[model samples]
Target: MAQPFSVDAVVWDMDGTLVDSEPLHERVFYATCRRHGVDLSDLDAGVFVGVHQYDVWNAVAHRFPPTVSREAWLADLDAEYVADQGSLTAMPDAQRIVSTLHAAGMKQACATNSAGVVVAANLMTLDILPFLQATVTLDDVKEGKPAPEPYARACTLLGVAPERAVAIEDSITGLMAARAAGLHTIGFASNHHIAAKPEFHVLADRVIHRLDEVLSLVTMPAAAR
Candidate 1:
């Protein structure tokens, strides 16, 4: 079947879509929470996968009985993630798809809820930073995923309309933002949370297993090329 419209660009979610940093993030969040006397063991850290880093911290902070301020926890978490940059790993086909899309002349941007520090570190780790036209994070907008602002900011930076772009994400929150921006959406089931959450899949037009499959699903418009 012909695509409804040629995909002129792609906006991707960072953590699970392009890079498998969920485990690393989870570990760090859990560790940070532990230090603050907040036990996240009972709560699924998976729920925070695509949420804004500050929001996550605030929520955890509210639940914890820690005497330390949330700002202190944020500082400590940032320090740890910077020191443990070794934890980031590219998802399957992340390189192949990104490189191919760049070569095809598709504009690309990453819309992530992670902080700039983590986003920069992961992009550098995956070696896809140079391939992207823009990167939008919590710091870039007043609202994060589940809010259309981040994706809207990304589309604006990429100089593309949301309807002409495809958004690939791993979490419902990310998909919600993409959909709210009127972008076509694909769910990358690389995160374990994808299985536990059926409603997330319902938000996507299609769910893909490997990043390379994105190449099969989209083609940059001739004008962009």
Candidate 2:
């Protein structure tokens, strides 16, 4: 393949985009809520899927009050996630895309709404930590997804402008952040929401169901070769 346009960097969102961790997280979150005797029976856990952790608490505070404080419930969930980290798996073709891009010498960074601890845990579990040149967690920015700060910070840390980079995301929150940061966004519609909620994925410059498809989009036009 010959090259015309080149992608200088890739900003990734880890949970649902790169790994099948969101389902596990959803189960753990509800289980922790029940352990504390918080009733989430009425609320569909899916509603909280793409929201930031801090915002999730705020959104569910009154309706799903846990026996412990908000932070404690989150701590419990995080610990459960760590304990079950082994159950997590990389999304189909996620490792392939990352490895291929890494081999191609493109810069990469992970910008996740999750805190550094969870981010590091999953990255290590997937053995993808080495391929990523940088990681920007919620701890690294004033604001996380749905806000441009996290993605922008990732671009800065990667030494690339947002326009020169692309972001692979699986949800509205992260896609909004990437678009706002001035990067081309690819929406991974591995779940129903991304495929069904066309209005929600409006920020995505392109939408693909599989992670491997990203390679073709990021690379140059075929005619250029």
Candidate 3:
């Protein structure tokens, strides 16, 4: 049984955790790279999981000809992603977990490395915005994941101390950010990008294969401690 710990708030990672958009993102990223004449293998996509799109753009720019403007490449990718929002869906148990937490009177927020534009589009598409009290994006922080700034800023925005919050993540980078912020971390392994990583085993406080299992943590008596 998981021990209970009290938290005034809960923070979430948007892409793979709340929304089943990882596969879509991989597809879009690869397509975008191909359009820019940059080739990325499946292994490359897996390795880049959890990084910000701009970071990926920078890397892609380095690999491709300098003639490819980073801003243009990023803009094209963003446009494609936004257009595909209609096909986005909430992860299994995501809606239920968020709804349950809201009903339980716990503060909820989304802290993601994605840009605000992307975050807002997906949140609206998945219809999970009503349950989110705060939304922090890369634009809101000086650095992206693995830096802890985003997660720290999110805790500040929620008026909750890091130790009094729980974070759900699906990537090693996201886990590192949440852990660095001193928040309890739960790793969701539903995404192939993270499922294959050995680091996840020791990085997260707990790991769950389905989004619904997340509710178990919130309800666990240990979580209320």
Candidate 4:
């Protein structure tokens, strides 16, 4: 059974949650690392999941020669990813869920660990800019996910309290951020993060494979009124 729907706002994670761009992102990461002569294994790729691109670059740079410039490497990686955004896709039922929520008068916002440019590109790609009431990026916060600042900032922007917001996330880091912000969370397991096990117990207050399941949680029950 699903939990009852009672939240006033929905806070979304843009990357893997709203768009099917994680795999493409991984490809770009591998390509960029190779171009810089860095060998990244699958596990190394996994470690970067849900982290901001600049942070990932800085971390990766630590494994390279001391003289290597992290800023230059990050710029190159950003260039590659920006050029590759054309291949991105909206996740299953993303548009449907978002549209339904918007029509229902529920507040909606995007809280992502991604850069502002990346978030803008994705919103443009998915044609969902008009539906989103607020957008928060890593640049807007002193700290990113797992720190709670992103989600907290998002709720503030949306004019909603943390307890009144529901967060939809696809990675453990994202789940932790939302949880830390005191919001109810739903975990989507379609991507690499939760593919191995139904780790709902670890990341989310609730878990569902399909986006439509969110409707049950966000919609008011007849008995409640």
Q: Write down the lDDT of every candidate, Cα atoms only.
A: 0.84, 0.82, 0.83, 0.81
lDDT of 2 by residue, 96-148 (tens): 78988888778889999987778877887678878999999888888888999
Which candidate leads the pack in TM-score? 1
Q: List the residue pairs that clash in candidate 4.
A: none
Taking every candidate in turn, the Cα RMSD to the unseen true structure, in Å, is 1.8, 3.3, 2.4, 2.6
Model 3: colliding residue pairs: 3-222, 4-222, 4-223, 5-222, 5-223, 6-225
Residue 102 error, candidate 3, Å: 0.6
> What tens digits encode model 3's per-residue C-alpha lDDT throughout 98-159?
88888777888999998877888888866878887899998888899988998899899888
Q: Cα RMSD for candidate 3?
A: 2.4
List runs of model 2 lying over 4 Å from the truth.
1-5, 64-67, 220-225
**Which wins on lDDT, candidate 1 or candidate 2?**
1
The order of the candidates by TM-score, greatest first, is 1, 3, 2, 4
Across 143-215, the per-residue lDDT of candidate 1 in tens digits comes to 9989999999999999988898889999988999999999999888887656458877789887888887787
Of candidate 2, the 10-residue stretch with the lowest lDDT total is 216-225
Rank all candidate structures by their lDDT, best first, as comma-separated numbers.
1, 3, 2, 4
**Candidate 2 local distance difference test against the native:** 0.82
